[model samples]
Target: MEMSELTALLTPEGLRLLDALGTVETTDAAARAVSTLRAAGHGPDLVAAVVGQAHLRAKARTKFGEFASRMLFTRAGLEQATRLSVAARHAGRLRTAGITHVADLGCGIGGDSLAFAGAGLRVTAVDADEITAALTAFNLAPFGDDATVLHSTAETADLTGIDAVWLDPARRTAGHSETRRVAATDYSPSLDWAFDLATRMPVGIKLGPGHDRDQLPAESEAQWVSVDGSVVELVLWSGALARPGVHRAAMVVRGGHTHELTAPADSEDAPVRELGAFLHEPDGAVIRARLIGDVARHLEAGMLDEHIAYLTSDAALTSPFVQSFRVREVLPVTPKAISAALRAGEIGTLEIKKRGVDIDPATFRKKLTLRGPNAATLILARVGSKRHAILADRVDAA
Candidate 1:
């Protein structure tokens, strides 16, 4: 959004209109709301800003929950904003480390800064973009003097007395939408500068989960986090912010429950064994953290393949780190043979899961001629270079 539009949005009349408009869910509804506001003599700029914000607030519910309603967001800021729950965890870590003051460099929309303030830490939230900084200031207003928003680059921000630093470097293009990923070396403030700052003070850096592991600093504690089955981001903690004796961690947040596995170093891969009665799929966080072997050891399981993350065990074992499935039967990897097996098993609906293969699940689903009275999950994987289709039933955690 333009600075003029933002200035107008902060005005008394604009605030009143935005408060009255509530949330506009659908595009049709937003269009109608915009038309009504225009008919009421509002200018196109004001109408457009309020209507766009209404839709953004609605979408922000997934990340910020109720707090989103009172906040303004830039399209790019909201997309990159950390989920409140996840931010809360970051805040807890800082609090636990005895950090009283934090400098949130490149604080997008003040999401993490808000968490830091709420955790009772004095926060200096800085964003280089004028509009984003203004929006952050608005979002953090409720905290009064506890939080301060600044419009400046991370490299230029003053960090003299800040107890710790939280850096979220701009990893994508400048646009609000249609943004493409930028290389790590090209990150705003640069990874080099960020890492240097980390050594001088306790620091936490948030990066994409798929970031090249080889480029990561070995001295930092790296944690991979997954929320509701989707791997989100990798966080690097340095100095006092890094947990004691924990160099690598996988945090899984599912159904409001949080679980973590930590190790000092990468765990060895479990031995590959024949298919057992049960198949286990490690959480994405665990897989990304390279701690799948640790999870396999906990479940008394072995890897299905040396390279694949799938695990199997003879006994019915349960763990928060892995989803257990009861293997019913093994079918031939060929589509025709798999279709015949499913038909004979009376499986009408199928959930196809594949790893270490190139087949698209959607296309493969279309090829299957399923007709029956049951539902089953089909796991297509390679065992010692040989492909096999395993039918299994999901075992829900009790």
Candidate 2:
């Protein structure tokens, strides 16, 4: 949302209209709402703002749940905001540390701030962008005096009264609607500054899950989190927020339940062996946290290939940390041969999962010309020196 649109939306009239409008999720609904509102003598800017917000609120339910209905968003802010479930976990760390006040630097749309305040802690939320800060203030207005919203850069935010820091630096270009990711070196309130702050205070630093591990501070606890199979973010905890003797952590959240795997440091890879009855694809968080060996031992598994992350086990075991697949049979890697095998199996829908290969699953799925009354997952991988396609049935996580 632009400053002009935001200015119009701040009016009492605009907020009421946005709430009354419900959800304009479809293009047709948005268009119709705009026309009807304009026809009712509403200004174009107000009409646009409320309609846009309605769409964003509907989409944001995936992250903020019902809170989004009463909140506002910028396309970029919503994209970068942490999920409520994950943010609550972050707040739990602060609560456990007995920190009562938190300074949330770069508080995009106040997502984490909401979690903090909801946990009964006072929140000081800061954002560099003026429009975002204003929107954040409005979103957090419900918390009243408990939440302080600031339109200041992280460097300028006063933290004297704070107990801990939650710094999520802007990792994208400055914009309301359309924005692109900036390089790590270009992050606002640079990582260097953030890490320096970490050394002195209890801090939780959120970064992209794929952040260079070697660049992370040696003393901090690095944790990778995934939600329902999608790796979300990497968090570095220092001071009171860091767990003792725990250096690498993988937190997997599925169906609102969480299971965590932690190690003192990255674990060595399990020895390689031939394909077994079950193939385990470790969760992305597990792979990124470099604790695959811990999970491997838990399942009595070995690396399918020395250089790949896929694991194989003769034991019929599965864990929350991996998506286990019952390997049916290995088929030839050639497109024609693989398609023939799939067709003979009566496969109608295929899920292609690949690692250590250069094939695009979408294009390859089309080439396979799937047809029939069955669905199966195809595992494309390099085992030893050769590439192979393994037909498999997904074994739901226990």
Q: Highest TM-score: which candidate?
A: 2
Tens-place lDDT per residue, model 1, 323-373, is 889999898877898888888889999999999888888998988879988
lDDT for predicted candidate 2 compared with the true structure: 0.93
- Cα-based lDDT for every prediction: 0.91, 0.93
TM-score of every candidate relative to the true structure: 0.97, 0.97
Per-candidate alpha-carbon RMSD to the true structure = 1.4, 1.2
Q: Report the Cα lDDT for residue 35, model 1.
A: 89
lDDT of 2 by residue, 236-310 (tens): 999999999999999999999999999899999999888999999999999999999989999999999988999
